[model samples]
Target: MNKLKFFVAALLMIVAGTASAQKTGYISVEQVISLMPETTRIDSLLRKYQSDSLNPQFTYMVQEYNRKDSMVSTKDSVKLSAQVKNQIRQELEGYAYQIQNWQQITQQALQGKQQELLEPIYRKVEAAIQGTAKENGYAYVLNREALIVVPPADDLLPLVAKKLNLKVPAAGAPAAAAAPRR
Candidate 1:
């Protein structure tokens, strides 16, 4: 029984050592995504949409709110009846609230459009990562941003790029910015 127990313990140690030897790599997913060509097109679309549609609406709302605010602020309350003053106050408040809400809604809509446009690009990158991992015998491919410390030469960006048939751009290539979320 002691001999069998000793053999089992030895086998476990060997298995553990082998498992720990598996290849692991990290990649900056944000950087990789930003480098994708589709990102530029998506950014262009987002900018155009903001300038053409959302901005005009936002500007109109701001102008309307400003006009109402000016009227409310400049009006002589002593000359106005109580009912008229109250109505003007409520109108000003309504315009202010709508302007605030419109800004929030427009921001959210833009973010949604950005994510929608990038979904396919993200999927392609993901597929390339998985293919590279499988071909390279990597046991783990972690996101660099999530790691406390990443060893040099452990980044899989070039490897994944090769798998995707993409040319690795210069180190200082422009990064794509995500939509504003605040």
Candidate 2:
């Protein structure tokens, strides 16, 4: 019995030592991305895409809807064939539906565009974070946003930002403003 108790105590000590050796760090990826200079350019590109491409598409859809609606309203329905009238009505309804949901459609398009533009930036940040963690002997890096009761882990933002050649605000300075959500 004494030998068994000694073995169990030894096992516990080993486990505690292993746990203590592993270092953890936390970082806010959004914060890092916000500090990246490319983010501003990406925001500008997204706005241009919305104004130049999406807006024109919406305008064309509205014009087509108006033209079809006017044809159905102003023309003599009595003289029109039943099938032709039904087809035009269906087209008008489709256009109306699209127009009604334009906001959702445009938002999705903008989000997709934003994601495409930010993909490379995300990869770059990921690489920097990994390098920082390895260089600083961190065993795990947690997302700051995901934690509520964070333990005494190192804040890896400054280290990761430096690794990426990005500037971090001085201590006690206001946190970097988050990038605009699409």
Candidate 3:
């Protein structure tokens, strides 16, 4: 009976030790990404794409819409031939459709551009995180935002940033506003 009890106690200790040995760490992914110099470059490129490409295209579309609208509104419908009036009306409707969807189109373009510019940077950050975890023997690395109870020691932001050769921001440093929301 004593032997049986001792065996069960040893088994419990082994199980508990194994569970406790698994290292869980957390990283503030957003914080680390913000510190990377490439992020600044990517942000600048996205802004330039928006201002140079999307804005001009949107302005042209708006102008076209306005021109069609003015023709539809100002032209004398009674004196015009049925075919001409119908053609003008069709043109106006097309312009209206384009105008209505313009914002969505621009927004999609912005998001697409952002993703294109950020993918490589994101990959680099991921590699650094992976390397940090592997070197430190972290079995699981959670995003800081997702964690409920995190100790300061378990935060891997500095380690990952170091691996990426970036400086970590001071604890009380104000965060820079990120690029416009998607």
Q: Where in model 2 is the C-alpha error above 4 Å?
A: 1-5, 76-79, 148-153, 172-176
Question: How much is the lDDT of residue 119 in candidate 1?
Answer: 82
Top of the candidates by TM-score: 2
Compared with the true structure, what per-residue lDDT tens digits does model 3 show for residues 35-141? Answer: 87877888888889988998888788778878756665775556777788789788878767877898898888888988877777788888888889999999899
lDDT of 2 by residue, 92-118 (tens): 999899899999999999999998899
- Give per-model TM-scores: 0.71, 0.88, 0.78
Write down the lDDT of every candidate, Cα atoms only: 0.80, 0.89, 0.81
How well is each residue in 1-182 modelled by candidate 1, as lDDT tens digits?
A: 99999999999999999999889999877767766777778888999999999889888878877875666567454677778778877987886787779868887889988888888877888888988888888989998878997887878999987776667776787545642221
Q: After superposing candidate 3, which stretches have Cα over 4 Å from the reference?
A: 1-16, 70-91, 179-182
Residue-level lDDT for 126 in candidate 1? 86
What's the C-alpha lDDT at position 124 in model 3?
Answer: 86
Candidate 2 vs 3: which has more lDDT: 2
Count of steric clashes across candidates, in order? 0, 0, 0
- Which candidate number maximizes lDDT? 2
Clashing pairs in 2: none
Candidate 1 minimal-lDDT segment of 10 residues: 173-182
Model 1 TM-score, all chains together: 0.71
